[model samples]
Each structure stands twice: as structure tokens, then as C-alpha cells.
Target: MNSGAKDRPSTSFSGVIRQNFATKISLCLLMALTIVVGANYGWRRGLLVVVGGLLGVALYYSSFGFTSAWRLLVFERRGAGVQAQLVMLAIAVTLFFPLLAVGEVFGQSLQGFVNPVSVTVALGAFLFGIGMQLAGGCASGTLFSVGGGDSRTLLTLFSFITGATVVTFHLPWWKTLPNLGAISLVDQFGWIVALALSLCVFTALFVLVGKFSTRETRSLVDDGPVDWLRSPWPLLWGAVALALLNATVLVLSGRPWGITGAFSKWGGHALHAVGIDLSSYPYWAEYDFGRSLLGDVPTTTSLGIILGAVASAGLLGKFNPTLRISKRGAITAIVGGLMMGYGGRLAFGCNIGALFGGIASGSLHGWLWLVCGFVGSIFGVFLRKQLGDGPYRNTQPQVEAAKP
Candidate 1:
């Protein structure tokens, strides 16, 4: 133990014993749950769960989060996170387009999350941006935080589900907004051309951010032999890993990784369990509503993420959960989560689903989502300043980690 261990009274015998017992019990339950579910389903679903768990591990260790990256860029003009995103996008587009064109990765069919360029996408992404700021996390951020033992995120998750469920009832009206339907660069142009175009955009972003960046933030990544198991991974390495994981999702699931859609589904199921009928909803009818309400790929993957986050946080000695939060903060979390859920439905995805996955797949809607989402984030930042804590309101200044 560290020299200061004795100085911290919170690590008392009772507390330590209780926490350790809880952690062990939680781990056992999670493992048993995964095994039972996988055995009942199939190997493919099991693998997907593993992938989600691994993704959670990667996200937690890396701190390669989109919400903070955007927040830092908009508020502080810090572009390191933005640069990392561009790197990830560039790598994803390069790999994804080529593989998608081939139509199979080891015999698994591949597809992308292509959506229409529409008014809803623009408005939806903007709303989602503001929600993420207010909520203190995006879709992926929420799930991982919950896994990492954040009690606040549980509220965010609940609100998100509620908001998503509400959107289903009004989706028909939202869909009526003018749309161009799904458009893909790879479909219009060849994979080679699409890749080139994507790279050019990434290069432009790189140059623009580079010109404006005053200080390059060093990542917390260590290059030691056991660094892979460590927290605070290098930004670039995290970005690369996320890109590969997302591409792997496309190959395995025949679609890019999405977060909020499953949330909405789960929310709907919750309603149904209480004797509410959702079959009449147009959104549910478009897909196999009843069957989907039962666990699907996305939902299982999400479940995996929470447990994975839990495992990672526990291993790192960071699994601290507290119910202490100001009333104002709690309200903000609920509202933020609601906005994310509703906006994600309107936009066809959240930050991970639309912005990251969409753009990587060469969809124009994805680009629109970013522009609109960023605009919303600007408003969110302003609202955060007025109503609650803004991203820049931190008392401690951020110190960049030493370069590897």
C-alpha cells in the first residue's frame, strides 16, 4: 500500500471489507449473468458481449471520451482531443470503407449506419450536443461512467431512456421533415475515392486545429510493458483503438456501433412490463417491435459495457460510488439525459451513433450531425454557465501528462 494509506481514515477495516465483498459479489453476478445469457442465446451474441466489455475497458483506461474533447475545444480552444478524434475518424474511414466495399470480414457481412440528410438530423444533433454538456456525458460517456461507479450517471441513463421512449410516439411527425434518405460516399463513389475524400477532410481539420492550438496536451499513456492494462492511455493510441473497435463492430454486427437506440428499446420494454402497449407506435412497427423488445445485439452490448466498466474501475481501485449530489446537479442530469434521448432519436444517433459512426461510414448526415451538434454544444456551454457548472468552471487547472 502507499505510505498515505494509513492517513486516509475512509479506508477503515469495515469500509474496506464491505467494499471488497460488494465488488467480489458484483463481479460474480456479472460473470454468471453473461454466461447464462450467452448460453441461452448463441456464440455470436456472446462474442458481441465480449466486444462490448472490451470496448468499455478500452474507453475507461484510455479516457478517450468525445464529450470532454468537444467541451475542451469549444471552451478552452484545446484541440488535442479534437485532433485525436480526427485521427480516429481518418483511420476508421480508411479501414471501414475498404472493408465495407469487400462486403465481408472473414465471411461476416458488413454495413454502415447511413441515415438521411434531413432537417431533423440538424436539429436533433444540436439538441443532443446541448444535452451532453448539461448531462456531463454523451451516450458512450454515460454508459462508461455508470460502469466506473458514478451514481449520477444512473439518473442520466434513466432520463435518457425516458426521453427516447417519448420520441417513439412522435417519430412519425419528426420523420416527415424533409430528408434525402440514406446516402453513402462509398455507394456514390468507389471506396478508394471515398477514402481519399474522407482523408482530405481529416487533413484539413488537422491543419486548422494545429494552427490554432497553443499547447499540445500530452496524454496520460505510459509506454511501460504493462501499460495496456493501465488507466489514462495516450490519446492517439486510444483513438486508434476506438477506430478499430468500431470497425470490428461494423464487420461483426453488419452495422456501426450505436448506443441510444438500444436505450430507447429498453425504455419501451420497461413501459411494456408495466402493462403499456407500444405496438401501436409507428417506430416500433417499422422494426420487429415485440421481438426486439427482448434483448438484441445492441442491448446486450450495452449491458456488457456497464459490467466491463465496473470491472475496469474495480481493478484500478477507482470504483467509488456515492449518492451524494446537489439537487440542482440531479435535475440537470435528468434534463440533460432527456434531451440526449430525444435528440438522438430525431438525429438517428447520438455522438457515438451519428457523429462518430456516421461520419466514419462516409454518410453526409454524419457531417451534418457534427456541425449541428457543435452548434448545440455552444448553447449548452452557455446554459451550463448560467444554470450550473460549466466545463471551464473547474477549480483545478488541467496539467498535461508527460509525453511518452
Candidate 2:
């Protein structure tokens, strides 16, 4: 190990201090931003915004789908790999929009609101999901993955932009079906009922998936065969804890949970720096499910995700060094970025926008995105195999193995 690492060693006081500083500052900033967002949108809406984000993250994690993507791609988990994903899909199907009806405290702002739904919106959301999975990361996942120095995400991120653009520009041509729909599950149902129903469904699926799931080589962070987190004592509390935190964010944040808007913004700004015009892209025709309601440029949520990712990575000792894009990958990143930007516009959202934000708000569009995205993921998995996972990989064992 490097002398600096040896001296601080993460467990050491100095290391802990360093690790916490980033998050502390981030949390403070995030909360402040949340307050501002809440004030602008109303405290109830702001709170719901944060809670929605928290719920999305926790539910997604507890369901154990997104984490598997890490193992399959980063850690090389394959074959039965789809097992975790399948469970997540079930969870996504079950709780995503249903929770909207009951409400999540602060979500009162969204209590009566509903996203207009249509077949076109559904198709767009679905396509976006698949595109994100293939791209190897959704908007939120891409932020986290890229923060950890994964170069492959750059490819998918770019592809997402390209796909979005392609879809957006052609939106007028495909305006064949109802796209936006009304809120079915909004806040009228009450939080208790929503939480209870959500928990009930999540529990049933968890048991089924856990019962049926195999445990050959499991990591503690994700559920798998022989998983410790899955054990009775830890499982219930773990779920509750994560769920509570998610609910809290909703009470504070105002909007729904999301991670792609700002990320896509990075790609957008990059185009501008090089004299490329983002305005050339259609603003109305694109997939941005939620317009810039938060604020002008560098919205708090997107910024939070990027910084949160950075903070998370640094604390975990995963931050190494890399420009993260080069050669064919560089070309891919730019193209993919455009696609995602355009796609986000066309589809009305990216992974978080459509999947988490839309679903949480009781939008049918979110659910549609999930279905189509799953189909797209299969194709994405194939692409990852062929093109190679961007430019990053686990170096610990793989590095030693590479030794001749």
C-alpha cells in the first residue's frame, strides 16, 4: 500500500476525518439546497422531493437490482446475474408508482399531481430504461459509476444522449398515441396505507426472490446466496432504515428523486465549450419529463448527485486517477452524451426522471420505462461483452491475475 494510505488506513482517526469531511460538506450543502427547493416549491413539495430521492435509492438498493449490475459488470458476475435484476424489476413494478397514491409526508405537493400518460410516453420511458441498462448505467448509476472511475459509463452516457436526441427530434412524427397522463396514485391515499402496501409487496417479493435465489459467491453489499444482509435480524431493520431515510428526503426536497438532469447537463456544457450548439437540439421535442423547475443551470439535485458520488467514492478509497475518456471511448462519450441529452428531452426523463421520479409520483410513464428498459438491458449486456466495459475494472484481484 502507499505510505499515505498506510498512515491513514481509513480506520485511523485522520482517515475517518478526511472521509467524513466531503460527505459532511455535501450533506450540509444538499440540505441547504433542499430547503431552498422546498421554499420555492413549498415545504411539502420540497420535503417530498428529497424523500422521493431517498425512497428511490433505498428501494432500488433493497430490491437489490442495481447492485447486481455492479457485480455483473465490474466484478464479472454473469449468468444467474439476472436474478437480482429480475427481483428489482418486480419491486419496480410493485412499488414505483403505487406508493404515490398513499403519499410520503412531504409529497403532499405531489399529492394531487399526476403525470399525463400515453402510449408514446410509455414507449419512450421503456426505451430509455433499456438504453440506460445497455449503456450500463442509468442517469443516477452513471453518476455513481463515473465517480468511481468507471470509463465504460462514459460510452453509455453518450449513447443515452444520442438515443434521446434521436428519439426527441422524431417525437413530432411519433405523436401517435396519448403520451402524458393523469396522476392515479398521487397523495389522496395517505402515507400509512402507501407505506404498508409498499412494504407488504416488497416483503413478498423479497421472500420469494431470497427463497429462490442461489448463493454461490455473495458480497455483503448486495444480496445473493449466503447473504448476511438477507438474514432475518438485519433484513427487516435494514429495509426500514433505508425506507425511512428515503421518506425523509421527500419531506425536505419538494420534487421527486432523480440524478440525470445535471449529469446530462455536463454533457450539454461540454458541447458548448467546443463551439457545438446544444440549442440546435430540440428543447420541446426532447424527453425531459420535468423541465428546469428547480432553478437555472446547476440545479441542486443533479449537482448533489455528482458531488455525492465523488464524496462516496473518496470515502471508499475508490478514487484513483483518470481523465476517463480517450480515443474511441472519447468519440463514444460525446456521441452518447448527445444521445442522452436528446433522449432525456424526447422521453421526458432519464433513468431517475422516468424510473424513480416519475414512478414515485404515480406516473404510468415511469412503469412503462421500466418494462422497455428491461428488454433493452439484455441487448446492453451483449454490447458490454463486445465493446468491453468502458475503461475501468477492479484492479485488486484482476491486477494480480494479470501478473505473468
| Candidate with maximal lDDT | 1
Error (Å) of candidate 2 at residue 276 is 9.2
Model 1 steric clash pairs: none
Model 2 agreement with the true structure over 1-404: per-residue lDDT tens digits: 12333222266566567656755664566677678877776665454434433433333233233423433432342313333443333344344344444345433442322455666555555455444533545666665555444566656555654454345446666665655545444354554455455446546644664555444343233444533222211223334433344333444443444445544554454445577644545643343433444652224544444455545544454334345454655554454455445555555666556654565555556556655555555554445335544313233444322111
Q: Tell me the lDDT of model 2 at 203.
A: 62
Q: Which sections of candidate 2 miss by over 4 Å?
A: 1-67, 70-108, 111-113, 151-170, 178-180, 183-204, 219-246, 261-298, 324-345, 388-404
* lDDT for position 232 in model 1: 54
| Model 1: residues with Cα > 4 Å off, grouped in runs | 1-30, 220-226, 286-294, 393-404
How far in Å is the alpha carbon of 10 misplaced in model 1?
A: 8.4
Score candidate 2 by TM-score against the native: 0.60
